[model samples]
Target: MRLPKDPTPIRTIEVVPYDPAWPAQFEAIAAPIRAKLSPLALGVEHVGSTSVPGLTAKPIIDLDVVISSRLQLPEVVSKLTELGYVHEGNLGIPGREAFMWPDGNGRHHLYVCSVNTPNLHYHLLFRDYLRQHPDKALEYGQLKEKLAKQYPGDMDGYSEGKQDLISRLMQEAEALSGFALHQP
Candidate 1:
């Protein structure tokens, strides 16, 4: 199930070998948000497959900027908007707030969420787990590659299909941190 030869004008997806510069790229992008929303921003982290060293990804850096509460969203969104970010709302994930990163190349996802929420914590736990366990990261990479081929243009399908595998890995992640799931 290879991806279509010709895709839409949006260029919603692309395949690329992991680059060493992704972390720095995330840091560069997170800096301004960190400065402007320091009061609300608890911690900014680099997550997603690209953050791992040897994975193939869509060449997009994914970040999570932790805040204090959902009510703080408007002010944070305003700050991000001032920096040219396009607020995309949840895009389906109810507890998570996603943004369309403004570089025009569709190469980053700047997700905003509060520390009071579990979404960001889960992402961080999973990422950290994969970072500490390279074997798990490899397994996840293979699963992702297979899924991307299976549901090339269907983001929702691809994401949903990977839920089981993700959950299993996340269980391991949570155990590693001794962090039980907190209802969001």
Candidate 2:
């Protein structure tokens, strides 16, 4: 039998009710990366639905390793690679670089982003908004659940379905945050 070369290919879009352990899971994934990178990584953030209490989401954890500038990327990538994660370039998002573990390091989406990146801002904005607004989180969770069921095994469709709600929520979040976040 042949196996796919990509180690952590997300083949399906499975959204489930929030698990309380998600924060600990993010820590498990973050700790070592933090230890190794230390001063190089400004912060290893827990972003996406799993970061918000009671928000339904895919089991995957999303983390952003922040750096001061793209100048830090080479060392960041090297250190992460040493930790067994393969650098997957930007994966189309310019300011963020993606990395994936080769084994069962638990499912996660890891990105290295400079402090000024639009991608990083969006991730933080979305997570913070959901964390503070339970009502909005509930709405997002319901939408995600419906989309997950409607687009089983269809990641593209599931992601596409989230655009409208996410955009609206981001706008509200930016406005309430007293700043405007541009979409990338």
Candidate 3:
């Protein structure tokens, strides 16, 4: 019989009331990143729970920097590193390279993805769908709140709990957008 590994100790999940200031905070972080990446970035967008207005989230902004090709990743990473973002590889998600700034700048997540990558499209679609459908966004926010309470510091458990809802939403989003949902 296989035993489960001990959960990595992480800060407890904290879902706060939706803050009107989130967009400005996201822009504050995104602008500098976009300026630095420049022509290399086909698009830089805020894509995540915080992007949806009135959605209660964990107060971390998620930004996607879309590039034109995989060959461009090395230069993109080098440029971002010069600006103080530590490249953390793909973090198990292919086509989306993740990065983290040393603590204190802001609480945020960054991903560099190719323009043609399905993950990039999914992020945008999900964000747009939630923005257009406040009812669904509220439902998702409640689910997140419940899961955060249930799992506490267990990030894996919290994410796992949301898989079903995310899948359902993604399918709906894909159907609405006429694009197949692609896993990354």
Identify the leading candidate in terms of lDDT: 2
How much is the lDDT of residue 58 in candidate 1? 76
CA-lDDT, candidates in order: 0.81, 0.91, 0.90
Candidate 1 on 1-184: residue-level lDDT in tens? 8877665442334556678988888889888889988888888888898888877677888988888888889999999898888999998887788888576666788898878677787787888888888898888778778877888777877788879988888877777788977433
Q: List pairs with backbone clashes in candidate 1.
A: none
lDDT of 3 by residue, 64-140 (tens): 99999999999999999989999999999988999988674459999999988889988999999999999989999
Ranked by TM-score, the better of candidates 1 and 2 is: 2
Give lDDT: candidate 1, residue 71: 88
TM-score, one value per model: 0.83, 0.92, 0.91
Task: Tell me how candidate 1 scores on lDDT.
Answer: 0.81
lDDT, candidate 3, at 156: 90
Q: What are the RMSD figures for all models against the true structure?
A: 5.0, 2.9, 4.3
Which stretches of model 2 miss by more than 4 angstroms?
1-10
